[model samples]
Target: MEKNQKPLLIILAFFSIYVIWGSTYLLNKIAVNELPPFMLAATRFTVAGILIFIIAMMMGKSIAISWRQLKNTIIAGFLFLSFGNGVVVWALRFVDSGFAALEVSAQPLIVLVLMRILQGKKIQLMSIVGVILGLIGIYLLVSQKQILSQENSILGMSMIFLCMLSWAYGSIFVGKADLPRNHFVNTGYQMLMAGIMLAISSLLFNETWSSPWVWSSPVQLSVLLLIVFGSIVAFTSFNYLLKVVSPEKVATSTYVNPIIALVLGWYFLEEEVTLQSIMAAVVLLTGVYFINTKRKFMVFTRFFRS
Candidate 1:
């Protein structure tokens, strides 16, 4: 990579994680309305995993992994993808995409608490303030009578919160777990294992599986976008950016993504953007920004760099 070209690639990679990733909430919501969530997630990741392997082979990267690496990948895969992402997809059937995005924007707060509980890391003063603000924002967002009164909305919110816990712990786990050296290979193994697990979950739930040919055009397009851009391109860009930029810089995506998701959902999906939601977003993202101080930021870098 040339010096000048590196900068351009960096900008493009940031765009991928910020814009492309943010759009996934809407895509998943769109597809989940027509296709079963687990099946949709299963198909997307299964195809993406296979394509990643092919791309890796073409790039002269080996896909081979040791048994130990395989075991770790399965655990990471289940935690991060199968439950973390797939369950969120399921919840989207009940919650608006923008609302879901705002709720998930609290992930940094979750990670902070998890570190304290699991690793005995002391919470800093700034982070303590962040946590307080995050809790306030969450209460405001979830306490809306319209939201709470929606059928299955509470259940959906509860499940999404559980998924956040899974993702936060998965981050901590991956920071320490031994996995494949190549990030691409590691991601491929995780996605493949997660896809299989989601497939099994879909079967157990008795989800109806239909051929893509029969799916609505919007649903088909959404699935294709999720696989190609959401799963592969953005993920590749995320890893690329982590190598070239400060993880704090990469972590800015945490702040940008929900804003994009909220706007996109409101404009394209006609999802309501309530005043409370806007207020919650401001409070939540501000708290996340405070939580990303250098000392605390290292915790995120470890997981992302893994």
Candidate 2:
């Protein structure tokens, strides 16, 4: 890509991440109406993993890994996709998809605190404040009268929050591990592991797939979107963006995703957008923004002290 084209590609890639991933929440919700959450996620990831893995192989990316790498990836994959994504998909049966996304937006704060506790990383006062604000925002969201009135919303939201923590822990673990050389190939392996885990979970939960269970055209379309756009295209765009743009800039997708999810939920799914949810979204995203701003703040502080 030329210099002039690079900027446009970045913009387009960012758009893909923002729009495609945001839409997945609603699509997952739609698909889960007919399919069990674990089954739905398992099928989606299995197809995506195989397709992407084959593409990577064709492109000359090695798909082999050491035993230790495989073990670590299995652990990370269970945490990231089996719990992180699988639980979110299940929770959608009880709460709006946008609401689940809001809970996920709190992940950075949880990751910050986890890093402090597990890795003995320093907890700056600002990071602590971010965590606290994020907690309060989550409290406000879950304790909302609207969620309280709904059946199993509280349980669903709690599951989503737990899922976020799982994802954060997995992310930190993956960062510290020696994984495969290529990110795309590593992701394919991770998705494959997640698919296996989710499949086992579905069987353990006794989710039956009978002949009466029909996949409507909408459901089929939704699954296609999840596999193709959400998993493949958005992830490809994000990986590309990480090379071209600053990591912090790419991280803006954290805050952007929830709002986009909320809008799509309301417009497409007719999910309610309560004042409390909007308020919570503002507070939660603000907390995430602060959590992500740590490096910039540290640099500024050091400059002043010097």
Best by TM-score: 1
Model 2, stretches more than 4 Å misplaced?
A: 1-17, 210-213, 236-252, 295-306
lDDT tens digits, residues 1-306, model 1? 324335556677888988898999999999999999999999999999899999999999989899999999899889978999999999998899989888888888888888889889898898888888889889989999879999999999999999989977877777667888777888788889999999999999999999999999999999999999998888767655544554335556778788888998999999988898889888988888777665634554343332
Q: What is candidate 2's lDDT per residue for 49-91, written digit by digit as tens?
A: 8998999989998899999989987897788788889999999
Model 2 reaches what TM-score against the true structure?
0.86
Q: What is the lDDT of residue 190 in candidate 1?
A: 84
Which lDDT values do the candidates have, in the order given?
Answer: 0.85, 0.79
Structural similarity to truth (TM-score) of each candidate:
0.90, 0.86
How far residue 80's Cα lies from its native spot in candidate 1, in Å, is 1.1
Candidate 1 residue-wise lDDT at 63: 90
Estimate the Cα RMSD of every predicted model relative to the unseen true structure.
3.9, 4.8
For model 2, the local distance difference test gives: 0.79
